[model samples]
Target: MEATLPAVAEELLREIKKAFQETSHVPDELLLALKFIFGSSAVAALDLVDQHSVSRVVSPSGRAVYQVLGSSGKVYTCYAACHFCTCPAFAFSVLRKNDSLLCKHLLAVYLSQAAGVCQELSVSDQHLASILLEEEEG
Candidate 1:
């Protein structure tokens, strides 16, 4: 049976709270960002489950792809201009922040990409890519 939206949402919230409670080295900026994202009902909706997957794939142009499997058993694909996550949290994060990182959806994607288990994982986002580039340059 599929999980209801509220159930998934509540589960996600527990995970976020547990993550926050267990972290000792979290940066102030990250903590603030977490509070801002998880603090809101809309954003909180994204953290409702613990089961998911992430994978990476190479593009024709030689770029990495990222895929996310949401707790609701939905898949989201994001590659450059074609980014989509199965969870509403991903969209909520983007819509809520003009310039912020460390959202739960992004975290999920990053974890999935890092784990190398996503399908057709060749996905990228300009916004995320630019951040990586900036970090490299800095």
Candidate 2:
């Protein structure tokens, strides 16, 4: 079956977000990633994280998801590799214009992974459920 880029991208995005949210305490790797995205001080990045704005989430299948919590309490999945975000800023400002700009959420995930903060979570029946569901639904 042909891989739907969005789904695959979502899977990757989920994992990255999950790592940040669920990983054992925030490590230097994650902080480093934030620095890259938010700049050397990393104050803004920490602020976002401290506020629980950016986090890792669990999908219905039990897979870890990378998500950014909006001010409105809307959680958006993020795909750093594809520079995609399921948020209004992305959908309206970027997608509507057919632009290829990366949102802050995407940048955070990318920098976190690149800095070695996030990791590929181990697959489990509970977590794998989401992955399977995605395959079935998509």
Candidate 3:
């Protein structure tokens, strides 16, 4: 009855979310834990969060998506539900070779969510659909 790695990670994220709710910042120990768990992705993800580059876009019907603006100014779409990111790093590292758990963009989304720092935007369902289609086509 041992908890799996993913379960442990999810629990840790929940704890981080609670800390964010209480203090508006992750504690140093939790930050270290993230770094240990995620390696370089943790550092880049924190930088993205500090830069205010992660966003949560939602529609009236409750559909939502995550977006992260990379250092190169390209926006990457991320789906939290599937742990999927539309970024070259995600494709080459996370999916293709399986060398990483997530791309920096996906990690950024997770960190921003846990820290409650993502820019939240509400859009019409049609607009959200348009955004999804545009990302897919591009």
Candidate 4:
């Protein structure tokens, strides 16, 4: 069986998207321009990332693996330890580039995990096993 994300996860993604769309992802140069105008400290691009877009799901027994849906509406299975995502962005940017960089899905997962916004769910052992197998086979 497939592991499922909660309704809260989708809602949170929407909220994160909305919040992120406004005054977000401004590069440091833009921040520098703003700072010059306002005489304030410059903000970095990383500061604008919305960590709340991702929602993590765990089994009640803490043994299931869950997939995350991205802002593009695609499901990406992520392996935390490897800093990997099944998304094309990871394959092209991180894996192909031979670096530890992350795609948006992986970044969201990491950020959400850090912010404690990942949602945990109850799933069967098979669900977790299937996810792991898919990762391996993929």
Candidate 5:
């Protein structure tokens, strides 16, 4: 039972991403399903997507970084490939407490990518390094 839970969730997420890719917008039924699966995080992620807050920053060497401007007006660094996010909710609810699978910002990155709506930017590796080193204010 425990093992099947993650598999089920993964399948659902795949379906959601496919729907977004196919239609460029989530249908009402899919929205309801997302709400049931992700709760308020789903709503917040959708809002971020609507605001066009997700960005894909790529360096000349082909390294890519993802960032999301959260609802709280803070820019969060997200490594979607690694399932990591620099957000308080990710630290508290995902890592420390294990109560959630992802932070809203991370989810937003995934949704934005699936919809092919993320703001893409190309920069030098030095600039990418600067972005990675910048401190986040609480």
Candidate 6:
């Protein structure tokens, strides 16, 4: 079946925003690409996250918990959290680049945090599995 670009783009934008809200850094080029692909809608969503201080958290086994701030001010809790963005663009890039290149979520989060979009968080990872598992279930 032929996929709708707008629908796909919308999904991509949501995932990117989710990832950004939960991660610390997003790549610059990826953000630009999102803007190019999704335009103002994507930017507006990102702006909301930034305004709200949403954060992403990640906890990989045997690593410290990482708290990531999104460009839109959303916060994610965990260690190595970008692994969870759920954005097609990010998934494609990770699959195509073998995780070598940074994804758009990472770029957006980085820019957002740098701009003081939200508060900083430092947490431990032993409890991160629950967070990751929760996402998996959704």
Which prediction has the highest lDDT against the true structure?
Answer: 3
Q: Is candidate 3 or candidate 5 better by lDDT?
A: 3
| Candidate 3 lDDT tens digits, 1-138 | 322237666777788899999988889999898888778888998899999999999999999999899988999989988888899988998889987887889888888888877999899999999989998898
Best by TM-score: 3
lDDT (Cα, tens digit) per residue for candidate 6, span 1-138: 322224644465455556666674556766777677645534654664466443544334444333444444444442234333544444566566553233445444533544446444444574566555664675
Q: Which stretches of candidate 4 lie over 4 Å from their true place?
A: 1-53, 64-66, 135-138
* Stretches > 4 Å off in candidate 2: 1-47, 50-52, 57-64, 98-100, 111-138
Clashing pairs in 4: 56-118, 56-119
Off by more than 4 A, model 1:
1-52, 79-87, 96-103, 112-138
Better of 1 and 3 by TM-score: 3
In order, what lDDT does every prediction score? Answer: 0.45, 0.53, 0.87, 0.52, 0.83, 0.48
Candidate 4 per-residue lDDT over residues 71-94, each given as its tens digit: 566667876655567878678866
| Candidate 4 TM-score versus the reference | 0.54
Candidate 5 segments exceeding 4 Å error: 1-5, 135-138
Structure candidate 5, residue pairs in collision: none
The positional error of residue 54 in candidate 2, measured at the CA in angstroms, is 2.5
Predicted candidate 1 versus true structure: per-residue lDDT over 38-86, tens digit per residue:
4542233234223445555454456664545555576454443233443
